[model samples]
Target: MSDEVIPETTGLRYFDEWLIKKFLFSHIEKRIAEQSIKKYGASPIYLSERSQSISSLSEICKRRGILTGLGDLDFLQNCSLTQQHGARSGFVVLGQTFDKNLGEALQHHAQLIESGSIQFGSPDTEQQIAKFVEGIISPFKDESSRLKVCEDQALDFLSTAWDLCRSLIRQAPGYEPKN
Candidate 1:
């Protein structure tokens, strides 16, 4: 008899197990790479260009009598930025933009929480994380506090994921963290 291992479930793909294991093993590395790029500055030129293009589009839209809301303007600007600089540059620019947005959102949520405008635990996990950072940063009453809180959160998230992966690799057979 052949010694080949076959999946017990018929509907699953042939390599589903390998794929799942691979994803779990590499997820931490992916997070680290993302955090590192954000922290160490991967491509500032791309971001600068993206921001400039967005501003230009907003100006053009304004001059053309287009009644674009801020969200629409922002979306169009991002599209233009991405188109001009290619997908990779666009990805980095958008990633940083998202990070900034999260920080702002957190601050806003924190304000709502402080003012009793919103109930605690009502919002999703992302909203909660943002609110938490906002609260921690609020006490300092300076721009640096917000920056510090964001940086701390980013690092903490990355480190925690990495440590978890290490633990999993130690406990599971055929599981290895990617370099």
Candidate 2:
């Protein structure tokens, strides 16, 4: 999405830089680090989109000795899952998006996770994230669930974003229930 502020919201609907840094940064980075350490090894493995934003944070992480220091995408080529070094990058940044776009982003990201294409060296990483996505998108299929999971996670959302996210979820891959 453009950097333009959303018309109705007087700000970008998903644009909450403060919250992103204060909450999402530590929350998700820790998750990635924890999974890499617990499941694989106590090695640094940062991951994100191919952009300056991630690269900048990654550099910070590396300088602080938080990770092995991979702000570039070259790490994906190395067959060193056994040897921890640089970070892996994905096309999407799930936790940083706006509430309106999150459901759809989660849906797309979930496919990558489930298909085993987005391996982060953690066996259950994909499953763990997929379950989280399922909860956020379930309201699209069953409105009764509402925003319980989001609220539980201390995520602030917009009412309009909820509807938009639900609609996006409906259009995401595997939106159809098998049952």
> Evaluated with TM-score, which candidate comes out highest?
1
Best by lDDT: 1
For model 1, what is the C-alpha lDDT against the true structure?
A: 0.41
lDDT of 1 by residue, 37-154 (tens): 8899563223232233323222224366553334533343343332323332313223123544333322222221222133466647667667667767673343355457668878
lDDT tens per residue, model 2, 32-58: 676888988873745443222332333
RMSD of each: 24.2, 20.8
Q: Which stretches of model 1 miss by more than 4 angstroms?
A: 1-52, 55-72, 75-141, 168-179
